[model samples]
Target: MIYQDTFGFAQQQDEQDELKSFRDEFLFPQHNGHKVIYLCGNSLGLQPKSAGQYIKIQLDNWENFAVEGWFMGDDPWLSYHKALLPTLSGLLGANDREITVMNSLTVNLHLLMVSFYKPTNKRFKILMEAGAFPSDQYAVESQVRFHGFNPKEAIIEVTPRAGEVTLRTADIIAQIEDNADEIALVLFSGINYYTGQLFDMESIVKAGHKAGAMVGLDLAHAAGNVPLQLHNWGADFASWCSYKYMNSGPGGISGAFVHERHFANDKLNRFAGWWGYRRDKQFLMQPGFDPELGAQGWNVSTSPVVLMAMHKASLDIFEKAGGIVPLRKKGDLLTGYLEYLINNINQKQGEEVYRIITPKDQKDRGSQLSVVCKRDARAIFDYLAQNGIIGDWREPDVIRLSPVPLYNSFTDIYHAAEGLFKALGATNA
Candidate 1:
């Protein structure tokens, strides 16, 4: 697997790629009359070409069926989301009964917390990684305050060791063990949004359970970008946004996962609505809240058919490509090539001009490589943008370049390296 810093090598790799045709399925943003090298799937993915047709079908249904669209169209609005569960459940490694498509990421997280994060006088704290996405921090803080507990006293953050960019799995398990008595919930991102370090979900779950605390995950960055086994790992609950790796469009409909063990646990609390009521008895307009038997019981309002249609469009592509396994195989090669080229750039400079902070092992990271520019960081980022290299930027100095396997080719990686090289010169770094 020797990587060469040449266009010919990249082209050769692309020629051998079985999933190469998937690149043609997406619509990329144009720059200077050419398709831009989009390396920002970590933020938002490119639109699937089929997305329009998917939406049009629903729009036409609304036009033809009017209010009766709920029960009348080819894909009745009453059960539109059910068709999506098979593919979504396959991506999450969970039973169809355990997954449901619903509100945005944080909203789902808050709703799940209502069911899983049951705090008491003895165990009222929540344990999580430091530097989590601000939304998670805010959600946990507000939840803690709502229960009349001070956030400072109710939240425990696991920090990396001195001078380390990523957290070690041992440290995470130890933190869970150390705070076992006071922890009511152990929540963590499946992959850290900043470092791109994939956590050991199975070990974390076991440790949390041993400590008598519930475990949950925020898979906003990990959902479609990497393979997951939420059921096997025994995570109590989880939520993820579909926009990034799943490519369902910006602010897309999010999803949730609740283990079967909790399906019959009526002790859990939920903010119920008509959508969550038992489907068979729903039309009766009954009295008490009688939820559906599985994760669909968490649904709050009517289904957003259009958003689910957009999601179905991308998921059909995944099904055609044979699910996350093949995608992950291609993703590993694409990201490894990017890492190799970045290391080559640093070697050529004879100094560490770009320091990658993401985990080096493929098992510990997805498609993203979070690089820290040692000099002229902002200018270098702008230079890449001007050259049509679309990467994501974080404050201070980190630049995230993610080579998505579904639409990205090895040639894209080669050109991105060229952009980085030219950017160094353009910025005089």
Candidate 2:
């Protein structure tokens, strides 16, 4: 493929992009009368223009109907979440019965663990990546403690070998096989929040099952960024936040998935609430709890219509853009182009000044590239921000740049690279 350093090449690519029109649907941040080069969609996505309209309809229903809105309204509040499943299911690669939108990300993680992380005397360990997000670590630790097991004894963490920044698939599979006898659950992120490495979900799920353990994924960074097949992979459970790639607003409602095979397993325990009760008998307000079948059975409270409205607006965009496959194809090219530019800049410098922590294999990563600078990383990051290039900086020294397929254009990538090149020279101390 021919590569060009000029913005004209990026503009040409944008013209050829099948999903180019999506850029207009979002509210891009502005700086100095120019749209900021927004490469932070992996942290928080741009707001969809349609989100306002969707929320307005709900606001109107609340104004006109008041309490009656629950039972008698266009798109009744009681089942508002139902309309979201068809679109969400497509993103998750799950059956409609296997997925539901409710609760926040960490909350759903705990709830899913309650049902799937059943510990026995022989098999009582929980396995995870060593450098998992602190929230996940805390959740796993608490879950183990709740079951009267010390986290030190019951939690097994796998780390990358020395001189390696990313985990090898073969090593991960081997660890699962070695610990199969003692592990009750294998939980990992589909994409690491910091490294932006996309795990082999299907292979990991299969490996966990072979060892007689349930497999689950925290997809906060993976959902909507990559194609998934949760049902086909027979994954035990998965959970994700919608604020990032899903493009719902901050602290938006989260989603969960449970394999259909587990739907009929009455023995699986859960922390129940009224929302999980059968809809037909819900208004009856009976004493006994008859849970709804499938993933809805996991819900603990009534759906939040306002949040669902914003989510529905974003989902509509996903539907209009076709699906994850086409978006991922574009993502590969966009991210690869960014990598190319970064590497070119590094070559121009005497030594390797910048390093991309994300995997080189297209299948092993999503849109985000975690760049680790060898010198003055923070100063360089701040310089990029001041120049109207918006990417996020993690602690110590990592700048995460995500070129989202929905709103980000090839031109954005080109501009971001140019800003980085300028910053490198200007900010050197």
Highest lDDT among the candidates is held by which one? Answer: 1
User: Please, what is the whole-model Cα lDDT of each candidate in the order they appear?
Assistant: 0.95, 0.93
lDDT tens digits, residue span 228-290, model 2: 999999999999999999999999899899998988899999999999998788889999778
Name the lDDT value of residue 4 in candidate 2: 80
lDDT of 1 at 127: 96
Q: In candidate 1, how many Å is residue 290 off?
A: 0.5
Screening candidate 2 with a backbone cut-off below 3 angstroms (N, C-alpha, C), the clashing residue pairs are none
- Whole-model alpha-carbon lDDT for candidate 2: 0.93
For candidate 1, lDDT tens digit of each residue in 297-373? Answer: 99999889999999999999999999999999999999999999999999999999999999999999999999999
lDDT of 2 at 189: 93
Candidate 1: list runs displaced more than 4 Å.
Answer: none
Runs of candidate 2 exceeding 4 Å displacement = none
